[model samples]
Target chain A: MTTRLVEGSAVVAEAMVRAGCRFFAGYPMTPFTEVLEHMAESLPRVDGVCINAESELEAVGMVWGAAAAGARAATGSTGQGLSLMQESIAEAAMAGIGFVVLNMARGQGDYFQATRGGGHGDYRTPVLAPSGPAEVTELVADAFELAERWRNPVVVVGDYYMAHTWVDLDVAAAVPDPPPAPDWALDGSSGGTGSAKLVSPLGTTKQRDGVGYDLAAHYDHCAQRRQAMTEGIAPRAECLHTDDADVVLVAYGTMARYAEAVVTACRTEGLRLGLVRPITLWPYPSEIVAEACAETKVVAVYENNAGQMIDDVNLALLGAAPVVGINGFRTDSSAFGIAPDVTVENLTASVQALFEQYG
Target chain B: MYHRRVEREILFTGIGGQGIQLAARTLAEAAIADGRRAQLFSSYGGMMRGGNSDAFLVVADDAITSPPVVGTAWAAVVMHHEHAAGVWPKLTESSLTLINRSVVAAECRPGTGAVVEIDALDIATGLGAPVAASLVLIGALVGATGVVSADALLDSAARVLPSYRAEAAAVNRRALEAGLATTNLGHPAWSRAEVPS
Candidate 1:
């Protein structure tokens, strides 16, 4: 098999198919729209069902329902659409339904109500942010495993840049063989004992309490599983040139790639600098970051948001290493417009200033 | 092992609806088919139709250090005058600027490189396919740079243009030959190296 160049969304859709995702439901959103289109076009070829829901809320509900019925199910949306799906996602998390959710993230919402904590409350979701096309393919495969092993919802978060960008990928190595869904799955359960009991959320108070207690127990169990999964799959926070480095540059998602370039330039200029790229944004790899900070003088957290990931980086470093944030916000409506040319020269200057101020 | 060096970056500039991205993709694919590492980055801003659309490509044997092509480029294909003027500052001594004679009347740098003016619209219209002008331009770029083999380009056209493969293949071949036969305006020959592949 030869490696073919494929789109990022197409890669995710192909991974879903390989993961035995039999049910997909989502609303169309820019960047993320391609994910839905790909599933619509390719899922049916493999006898999977793709549903374009009326809204993001409905889409999440549909996936929750399908997953509860023991189907390998998935859905996707952008930041705004994801907000609408959070209620359902919270419910799914409570119900122990395993599935994947993709957030082809755009810029953060400008409105106050739609800010960083836009959702109902402070709840942590396991999020994997892919920097490039090759990473997108690999992360999707890993996401499926994480979702299934933990029996919880796994999020594959990509920004507007990542969704639209095209990179040369060895598609043959990326394409995974379709995994066999369990006999409990909807597609695999058809030939089973026709008398299999149906699982429902509604019942008598005693039965409901029993179900609720069982779900709570599962959630308690899930909490442990989530921790183990995060520890096991804690994405390696890439530390480039850190051995003799004085400054540590911390970034995630697409920004990490840019930061690495900046780190290389700084090293050439006789300044010892390194980069820490957090692949798993939710877990944030605090321990790894803390260990790096133990040696470094200062850590600079760079992000597209004003300071979303900065807080986590600060928490990770604690007070061991002084943390500075080099932050920018993309105010453009289009995905391409969002990526303003932050030159290496400018970044190097910023890193130097941070070193003087906090070193 | 065969290696081709593409030091100068090439940026394909055009309007959003002009199929500029497709042309870039085709070229990048052809380069890869010839065993060269290529990166294609297409930028489509807010406007879908009447907005500025551009694609950046870095083709080289070595790993690309910087993805964006900032100052100068080896060549540029401007579908219109506005695009030509917008990217003119990036042209250097080794740059070859190909303009559609029907749309732009820009002057080229003296003794820098040859500028081949072609009425691509007229030729495409004569062929009864105006949209195929992108393929025509791609052919011209191949003829001018000889970065990838003519056969590999045709194969890329067939691979990408799935619906109208036969028509696209024929028109692209003709356009490639037409471009190769065009006068060079006194610059050195820029043709593909003959290899026993």
Candidate 2:
């Protein structure tokens, strides 16, 4: 594959298009704006439509409309805009209409917002966090497939660092399986056929008319789909020297990249340290984390937020080891923007202190 | 201590409107065009001009494991003195320093890596395109570092220019060639570098 230098946003948009994404609607926000801009530039050439929606709610609503109409559609924004789109995201999940969601978050502060969405339901959004630009290409392609597979909304979580970083990568859509068709999708073909199709969150028209649709039964079906997703889909985690390390650093997204560098540096000095980076934040990769916690003495969770994913890390560990939150809230306090303050030295100190105390 | 670094990192610092972003991107594109793995991460304020602007670049013959917010850089390409003080502490002892002497008047420590001061602004002014000073610095950098070829940089520079800015490609090409002639590093860092399979 011939590598080309491109920013992460371009890589994501290219991957989405390669995955057959035909409709994209999003309101512009910092970091997330680039993805929309890229789609606006690329989609029309492919006979697809890209809309710069006036609001995040409108964007998600447009994506929902497209996805219901059998189009590979997507929308995105940061946490601030995503907060406004939560109701529609929940509706998409409940409505069983699949679409890709990009959360180019301001910082890691939106981990909880992504994993445990503000939308009303017992539904959980399958979230993937790619560490760099190269990984984003594959993950975005997989995200489209995963959303279609479970017939649910899938979120690709990132930060400004991941959105803005450019890398030399061959961004071709590589899906493992042939995606199943959206037979349930609504099109004008069903029009004037005396049997109009219904794509609603409550229940299908066929179910309501034929089986006397039960609301509890529909919710149960949604819950079972989630359960099947948990059992069927394999969680991806990148482990670095976790087999024999005394301390394991738990992180994801860009913060994990920093943790990796620090762990590599410490390993050279004979310090037994490693890192566990969750590629899928929602599935949580509890089994792998539990295994690592069994071997390591201390599990330090490093996040750019104030202990958001630490809850998941704790749940994964299940008291196998002491879990500490190294809240690396790196933000530019001036503009309420992101700051690159998670340095190797600071991470090294956090792990060294834990190693010294626990070892 | 062994840092286990395989990538060469370059940090570019300048004011907002000095074309630091474009220069860094061109360097990355040139590296990719030459079959090297490259990564560029840029940070600047929302200001239209005269704000602190910087870019971090990682060019490697193989996969790069270094994070974008690099703790220490292999080189610093200084285009202006406005934000040079903040970038100096990140340079290691073995880091190369290249400065535009016409615009940057700050004194640079010489104990570290090779320090080469090029009169890029004067050179660009002489070439009749004073705005392409960053390109001049990039040309000199490629000549001194051998990270990419001068011809490849010219090709990539033309490719990166927007459609509206297409009129200035020839002058930018000339500036790059002129900057390349200013440095004397002949051999590339690696000889017989196999084409990545």
Which candidate tops TM-score? 2
DockQ of each: 0.30, 0.60
Query: Residues A1-359, candidate 2, lDDT per residue (tens digit)?
Result: 66777887888888788878889999998889989999999888788899999899899999999999888999999888999999999988888899999999877888888988999987888999998787886798889989998889999987788777898877444533324448788876564547777777786545536656577877887888778987877888889999998999999998899999888888888999989999998788998888876888899999888888889989898888989999966575224245556777778888889977999
Q: Could you tell me which residue pairs clash in candidate 1?
A: none
For candidate 2, please provide the TM-score of chain A on its own: 0.92
For every model in order, the fraction of real contacts preserved is 0.26, 0.74
Model 1 C-alpha lDDT per residue in residues A1-359, reported as the tens digit of each score: 55465666777777678767878999998778988999998888877899999999889888977876667788988877887877766555544456888877764222121222244322345677776665676787777777776666778777666665555566553334456654444443444445433333221112344444354545455566556765676555666887767889887766776777788667666788888877776666788788776788888887766766777788787788778778774543355325444445557788988778765
Candidate 2 lDDT by residue in tens digits, B81-148: 87776567777777888899998875644356668889999999999999899999989988887887
The per-model lDDT (C-alpha) reads 0.67, 0.84
Alpha-carbon interface RMSD for all candidates, in angstroms: 4.7, 2.1
**Model 1 residue-pair collision total:** 0
Model 2's interface RMSD: 2.1
